[model samples]
Target: MDKRLSDYIKKVVTEHGVTSTLKMKLLLEVFLRQSIFVNTSLPPKHNKRFWPSLKDIYNHVAAQFLKLRDSCVDQKLVVEMVEEQRSLHKGERFYIRIKKDQEPGKFTDENFGMTKTEQSMKLVNILWEWPRMDLPINKGTGNIQGYNIATLFAKDIKTKLKEILELEEGDKRCYEPHWRHLQWIDRNDLTDHNVMNNSVKGMEERNKLFHEERWAEMSALVLEEFGLFKPKTIIGLFSPPGYYLSLKNCNNGKLMATLEDETGQRLNEGVRYFKDVLLVEARIIIASVVKNITYREAEELLYPLK
Candidate 1:
């Protein structure tokens, strides 16, 4: 991240009193203008348009940030917002205003005539911008969800993590949980439907890959943060059989594999040799399992996989 942009974001977030969406937009505009002349690496044009709009630039920046953040946590895993919620508890609930008359599927991409890749990138950006997490209460039903982290973790713990990472206050580091509400404004004036249908299809595919990648990424981060991979720590992985394959492939030999049944019974051998063991969650349905587990359960599951 650029130092000037970082400084500006802190200024707006702390003193501007403006909404996050507006602050991001303003910050992006300034960033692009400042970088356009100095940084010659940016493409001269995108989607047949010269000089990307503030929204386009912002989406690109957000996507890059997401990738960077994920890489810092775990290079092999690609964590998404939903998976992040599974590990981090939510702090507050709030509603963001949207255009009343906008259609169900319409979004900023529809208004900007962005490509499918661009739109999918934007959605990923939004997921990070407005992270949803589980509330500490309702650990069983999995119905509770919130938008921000309002002093959820102990201040000392947060401060220590920040110190370890060498991050100043208000930096958007992965360890520190915070709230960022983005106001969505409908753009009905621009009409470009020729590429809309294909773009929508692209988003569907992108979303599937995004979630899988995110799960792995968040899992790695949780393991490291909670010190679950320590020599004497007990770790459990409660995921479907399909997830096991990906975990094995990406874990880099850090996790030992063992088969287990739904009742938490070991299926492979009489002895559970490793600190980490794979167990099945009886309550999880293959189709809707992610939505079924609470954040606390998710933490319990991933914390030991370090």
Candidate 2:
């Protein structure tokens, strides 16, 4: 490291403590990782590979550091660093003076303006000096009801099915009952049918599609509302392995449609519709779980659907 840069880093380490140094180290690591991608020709967006841009990587690492700064560990580290610095400089006096004609990029060559290490240091400085904001009370640590949204979605399918079934049955029996109800129960009569075809299989299929679509839309909307676009944000979806399989199917269908070149746009639209709907439903469920309320209550709180 350049002497000036090393001294600057030492100053930051002394003043901000080990947490700040760790933040700087992490930033540099991300910068190095991003450099690997930047040097390569980027893969197509449709290629489901981890190839993030330098800016994207920087933003991600910076966000993580910000979160760390807000945590108790960071607070404790900062206190310890400050104390250590004070003890080390007990009799020394510190002073700051600005030199004329000293530019910020004085250390680096014009062609390679700022090195990644220097850039990382700058990012650390900004993070340390910038004013921080508290997350909203409702956001609640990006967790729902003490469980991750994805876990809830994956494990609580039975409960969800029961709720939807009960609701549907109530709607049919009490809200719109008629002589047709008898026909629905009989299953032998073909003259009249219930709204949902009067079979658990039929009802399950309908509920599955409904919940799937709802989960997609709700999850997407929640992500948008909360400004969570990273892969980690997908945890809010509460998706199971099967849910991912469905998403894979959607992607494969879209890819096939693209290859066909006919009905491609329509296929894309259908896939997008289902995916969005499922994500949104996941987000709603996550919010509900975190807020310790019913899914319906969460829907109303975030975005009411009448």
Candidate 3:
């Protein structure tokens, strides 16, 4: 993350009275701007996005999901997406108030003549300006020579999910989803056809790409203040709810923290393993922006050492 952006976010979260949801959203905004793909071989922030390794990626994604799942969705962008979908479906025109002296009551080409997909994508970019997720859409027409899109929603695993994005069982190719905002899905927007279009499909593929991956028994505590260096351990706060970062990952000889109370420091239950896995993913949070307490100090405060 950029230093300027990092300092700005820290000030926003620590000083301003913003909700945790907004704080997480601000993180997401920066996360999207980075080169998050694992296939890239570029240096960590060679003037671009950077996460050390796969473990860091999974941990970051899990942390983000947990934050979003636990927060309220009263964002203005969400409302605008919903209303824009409704208006587009109803074949309505938009009216804008410009700062300059403009002809009143005259329909301009400002937001006119946009196709359904184009119009929807226009609003979609407000949340994320990245390329939309490409899914093999079964259009039931002439598909590419060799293309197949499987199913997880249907019991038979063969039936086309008509209710979700109108994917039929037939010819198809990789297609961009009409709605790319997955955030809209969990916000009780499933009833709204437009917002719920390809969010489900995107999530299904994302689950396969991320949520279904194997655990490495480790944790990554991401912080902008720490820069490119990934912090692996934290002063675990185990009190009833299990607020703690695995001590085993503190091989770097120090524990880092992002919060004073250790309230939002931990991994999502989806990636947490206990039986055989040596460690589970957790976030570093406690005592100021990031206080790297020595291993001795960390162990004294740590509980039931991992």
lDDT of each: 0.29, 0.34, 0.27
Arranged by TM-score with the best first, the candidates are 2, 3, 1
For model 2, residues 141-229, the per-residue Cα lDDT tens digits are: 23333464345655653244223212212232212322222222222222223222344554443343333323333343332332111
Give the total clashing residue pairs for model 1: 4
Tell me the lDDT of candidate 2.
0.34
Error of 1 at 2 (Å): 2.6
* Model 1: CA > 4 A from native: 34-306
Candidate 3: list runs displaced more than 4 Å.
15-45, 48-154, 157-265, 269-306
Error of 3 at 239 (Å): 10
Winner by TM-score between candidate 3 and candidate 1: 3
What is residue 278's positional error in candidate 1, in angstroms? 54
Whole-model lDDT, model 3: 0.27
List, residue by residue over 73-107, the lDDT tens digit for candidate 1. Answer: 22212223344565575664433333456542243
lDDT of 1: 0.29
TM-score of model 3 vs. true structure: 0.19
Candidates 2 and 3 compared by TM-score, better number: 2
